[model samples]
Target: MIDKERLPQVAYQVMNEVHEEEVDLLNRLENELSDEVLDISKVDELLNTLLEHTKEHFANEERLMQEVFFPAMMMHQGEHIRVINEMKMVVNRWELTRDPELIREYFLGTLIEWLMLHINTMDTITAQFITMHKGGH
Candidate 1:
């Protein structure tokens, strides 16, 4: 589960909403992984859901950045593209191997670490830029 205290303070309300949804999704994924039966299908479903949500979230953030003429928009969008591609690779590998342990490792290691770092640094900077231009609180 993500620690709320660790989340950056963003002035945009929608950013906070998206962050909350991400936290919920992460918690759900963690719970699903903890099940003793280790349902691969369920894991696949959760991963797909996370991927879809992340895509939408990134798109929305990108749209906001574009609307506000954010100087770092290209860089931010590139990061989003990179992360989504990595997620696709992970999902594809899992589909081929059907290895629950591999999925677990990817989730607990790569995904979580990337998300925390992105949110703490890139997202935080983007949100601040958007807020400044949009006159958001």
Candidate 2:
């Protein structure tokens, strides 16, 4: 099994690359938003897809931590839960208000920015724990 610490870096790498795809999706929704042309169905699909991807990524990382007996697994997972909850909150807001600009700002800017930092810092530390558990393999 891969070490937990090393796994988060790999996760981070994959995420950084995939983020552009998320951005592209967001961009596709942008015009719809700005013009008040957003199809609620489309917005729902986009958010659902993004949420799914986020869940998958977190689960994969958590599995790696579990495999290696990473001590911080629960803490790491709690963070993931927080992210999920926040996304859910955003989804609820979007559903209630149907504010395209808010969705855009949340996903494209604040959300992405938060993720970049989370992956680089907290995730890197998680990776470090994995690496150490594996004797820096």
Candidate 3:
């Protein structure tokens, strides 16, 4: 459960909105996983939804970075790639094992931690750079 208040805000509106969406998706997934009668299909669906959202979000950010000629584009894009790949691997594991505990621990712990740190660091820097480059838009 991500406390919205605790989330670090980025300079860009679009990025902030996407981060909110990401949090929402993860929260929903966590609720679904916490249910005792785990619906494997529902969890799978949410996971897929999150993955798709992440892809679109990252693509949008990458495009902005390119347009702005962001100096740290390579590092930021590399992080996105790494996160996406890890998500894919998790999805694959879920399909093979249907392990609720595995999903729960990963989502509630690892994923949330990673998201907070990423937003606080890489995303904050990227958004600031983009906003500054765009004359504070």
Q: Candidate 1, 11: how far from true, in Å?
A: 2.3
Model 2 misplaced stretches (Cα beyond 4 Å): 1-36, 128-137
**Residue-level lDDT tens digits of model 3 in 1-137:** 88787889989878888899999999999899878798878988999999999999999999999999999999999989998998888788988998887887777778889999999999999999899888545
Give TM-scores for every candidate, taking all chains together and pairing residue i with residue i.
0.91, 0.72, 0.95
Ranking by lDDT: 3, 1, 2
| CA shift of 78, model 2, Å | 1.3
Off by over 4 Å in 3: 135-137
lDDT of 3: 0.89
lDDT of each: 0.84, 0.70, 0.89
Which RMSD does model 3 reach against the true structure?
1.1
Models ranked on TM-score: 3, 1, 2
Which pairs clash in model 2? 4-130, 5-127, 5-130
> Which ten residues in a row are the worst by lDDT in model 1?
1-10
- Model 2, span 1-137: residue lDDT tens: 11233322433344444445545555655655656455889778878888887788788778768978887788889989998999999999999998777787887677767766777776777666666665443
Number of colliding residue pairs in model 1: 0
